[model samples]
Target: MTATTSPRVGDEIGPLEVRATTLEDLVRWAGAIDDYSPIHFDPAAARDRGLPGVVVNGPWKAALLSRLLTDWLGESGTVTGLRCEYRRPDVVGGTVRARGVVSAVTRDGAYECVACEVWIEDGAGERTVVGTATLRTRRPETGGAPPADGHGRAALIGDRLRDALRVGAEAGRFTYRVEAGDLARFVHAVGGRPPAETVGTHVPPEAPPTYYAVLDPVERRELQLEELLDELPFAKTGGGNAFNEVEYERPIRVGDVLTVVTTYEEPYERDGRAGRLLFRVRRNDVFDADGHLVARSRMGHVLAYDLDRVAGR
Candidate 1:
């Protein structure tokens, strides 16, 4: 379990109770974070996109997987890394269960550590989100200039979208200070108990695992992806979060001001069940006010475009 009790390989974390997420729950989450699309709460909007119905938030699912790890570690440890992919969508009104099994356990200096393979499953017992998490006893605290300016990058879209996505293509940097009120609302939306504030002091017992999303905002960065696709070369189609991998230098305490520098990297095309898929990858590096690397996040998105248009139909 931690530095106290040995967590051996193959030890299980949970089969957290299969719980159905309600529309209100999704609203609470949407209000707390950036994922507020009609596809999350409107059935017709989902049907227009070929989904069976309204779907649960992918980041929310990632948070649930993180909870599985923290719930197992108790207060003795914190998750240092987590990576998850939404293999399949989970529709609203359906049940989701989380479980993890320790795959490796070792010692990192003074902290004991373990890695677990975790996933969320649907009622049919099929995995909807699958990933791995790394946990260690909390450790003490652990970027660079913004990439070359991006104003000239817009001319590089479409035929040269690949060029625009070349490694190190700067997407711009953003800054935010962690607020206890924001953290509390996010924790409650995910059904976690938030730490209480005393007088004017407010430090969470631990930062919520997936709160890093608030800092990244990868797809919506300087590129302003939506303003693209104005031409007939490719028509916009279905696209949203594809996956996310985050590594923390330390659990972010309240009031830490962070600036994240984002850049495009490893853009490529692959074939999915529908047809050709375009994947755009971004890396966000977060630094504290003192310029210490607080966290780094790499996020993948299924860029919206019609499959037929991509096929030259």
Candidate 2:
């Protein structure tokens, strides 16, 4: 059924147990996503590149966190929002666990819950990925029924597209140290070395590729949905609602500091069968240590109440 069906916060949602982090696991993760860097495989290369051992991809940890939440909430639950900060590299052979605790519930006639924090911890109790999320469940008696207020459908649609109205810039700078293990894990996950004098070298002898998945300066990633919701005026008009569609621009390498800057470029409104729909567009720029542009990404959010219905029954 659904997480809301349970109706309690402290209840144990689920647990992710960890075993030895293997090279094969790393390779499979990166290859599946088409990321290939040498540090994951060659020990000598890793040594030359100045890492203790192999490192794991930061996004993999984020994915694990996402899985933990979805599995705990049940198949019916949808991930409304997710924001992760990469603190430190998870090395090969290190054990980690993903855990969650119910933090708060927002009941506006119907119940919607927010998990304040979900984290991934290493064997020594060190956190790798720190983040938060939100989930919505249908009211029990009216499963699949229309909302009590006809405006619900229109509201959901409006919120999803409200991002287009935002205007201004948000910027932050983060620094992180690169270790050999971090590079190796990233290599295994994405596949291939960072282009080196010798094949099979775990670390690259020279600078790594722009697509390498390096640790950013911030130890804990922040998912500021509250701030984002506050910044956009449309979000306030119809009961703040939005949805995310994320895409990776490139891989981040180890020991590289990244400066992330974001801006609200445009906002637009459209009319649909349900009612009025709003759309918001935002852009993110990622820069390397030398202040050079590494990658750019654009994200759009759809604001509306009839999200499920719009998808088609």
- Please tell me which predicted candidate would have the highest lDDT against the true structure: 1
Error of 1 at 110 (Å): 67
Local accuracy of candidate 2 as per-residue lDDT tens digits, 218-304: 112342332343333232223222433334444555565667665555566676554456565556667777877766655555554
Return the lDDT, model 2, position 102: 72
Candidate 1 lDDT by residue in tens digits, 1-313: 4334567888888888547888977877777674558999999999999999999999988988887787776666789999999999999889999989989888888776878899999988999999998888643222122247656334335546645454666667788888877676666557643333333444365688788877775543544543443443665566778998899999886888998888888677777754457777888889999999999988887755664564255
* Candidate 1 Cα errors over 4 Å, as ranges: 1-159, 162-167, 192-205, 219-226, 230-232, 235-237, 304-313
